[model samples]
Target: MSFIQTLNDAWSRTQSLLCVGLDPEPAKFPAALNGRPDAIFEFCKTIVDATAPYASSFKPQIAYFAAHRAEDQLEALIAHIHEKHAGIPVILDAKRGDIGSTAEQYAKEAFERYKADAVTVNPYMGFDSIEPYLAHEGKGVIVLCRTSNAGGSDLQFLSTSDGKPLYQVVAQLAAQKWNDNGQLGLVVGATFPKEIETVRGIVGDMPLLIPGIGAQGGDVEATVRAGRTANGAGMLINSSRAIIYAGKGDDYAQAAAEAAKKTRDTINQYR
Candidate 1:
């Protein structure tokens, strides 16, 4: 299935919009697994299994693994998701942006090497930087629009000649010009619910990979009201630290499950 179809199917099957983000940090790991080899994989795998029932998708931030020299663990983690969770898509949160061969190599890294179902990318480099990923048919190329960080406004809010913010222009391009394959999505921060509403209006029913809900304090009700489609199914509401690190002991996985379930239920209430 295409990335969008698989995402929509997962949404229907799981009846949840919650996207479990895996951003493992060894310093934050529980005592039982803190110094263990391949602990990154072990920690994320446990969370995946515990929260699979409530998740519509999983997003693994690549920097977390790479920073710890755990790239192989990241690969294993994604493969485990494909094997155990089946239809649940994995989005590689790499935010890669380059042109020509460099972009192609990055695309290969995300799809061929990591086997990510989709990837978050920086569109600051323009359309050519994105075309290489589109070349990989059925894979999702999610462009960063209004990111969650406050520093994002430094560039994303700049005015264009048409009196529109840069992020809005990016949304317009992704929705109209750049979405030829119907596999594109936008990363609109849940922190900016009003911007999300503006982007949703521009993009129609395109899928949105929303971050900032849990640890970043994005409001669930406002996010849903602004981002959901007519069917209440166009957003992937992500919560990472609040869910994965809910417990610091041996029962961390169970605690994570509880947090995920609560988040899923809270999101469903608005839908």
Candidate 2:
């Protein structure tokens, strides 16, 4: 199935707008899964088994896995998740972009090696850099338009020569200029409610991967109001530490499920 079809299935089957971030910080794992050789993968599998039914998708930031030369372990974790949850779409949240060839290699690593349904890309390197990622059939290419970090304003909020913010330009380019395969999306941080609405305008009906909903102090109601498409869904609200680390002991899975359900219910309030 194609990327859009997989995501559509996930959203419909799970009845959720929640995208759980399986970023298992080493220190946050349960003591039983912390010091083991494959603790990262074990922690990830436990989360997937517990919350896959509640979450629409799972995203694992590459940096978290790249730490300590754990790429092999991360790949194993991805395979295990795909094996167990055959229908659950996984988004590899590696914000990568560079020259054409290098971008192609990155695409191969994320798509062929890890079998990710979608990979986030940084568009600052121009469309040529993004084109290589598009070559992967049925794979989503999410561009970073506006981020939630405090330093994001240093470039994102600045007005371009045409009097539009840089993020607006990125959204227009990605949505209007490059969205053809039904696999393109924008990463619009929920921290900026007004900016999220503005991005919705530029992106018409495109999917949005929204972070910062939990633990980052983003307003749930405002983000839903601003982020959802006309169909009342299209935004992926991600919560990493808040959900995965909800409990540190043996009841971690239950706590994580509760956290996921709570986030889903809260988002539904505004949906």
TM values, all candidates: 0.99, 0.97
Candidate with the greatest TM-score versus the true structure: 1
**Clash list (residue pairs), candidate 2:** none
Tens-digit lDDT string for candidate 1 (61-140)? 99999998999999999999999999999999999999778999999999999999999999989999999999998899
Off by over 4 Å in 2: none
lDDT scores of the candidates, listed in order: 0.96, 0.88
Per-prediction tally of clashes: 0, 0
lDDT of 2 by residue, 93-157 (tens): 99998999999999999899998989999988989999988989899999999998889899998
Query: Quick one: how many clashes does candidate 2 have?
Result: 0
Please give the distance, in angstroms, between residue 125's alpha carbon in candidate 2 and its true position after superposition.
Answer: 0.6
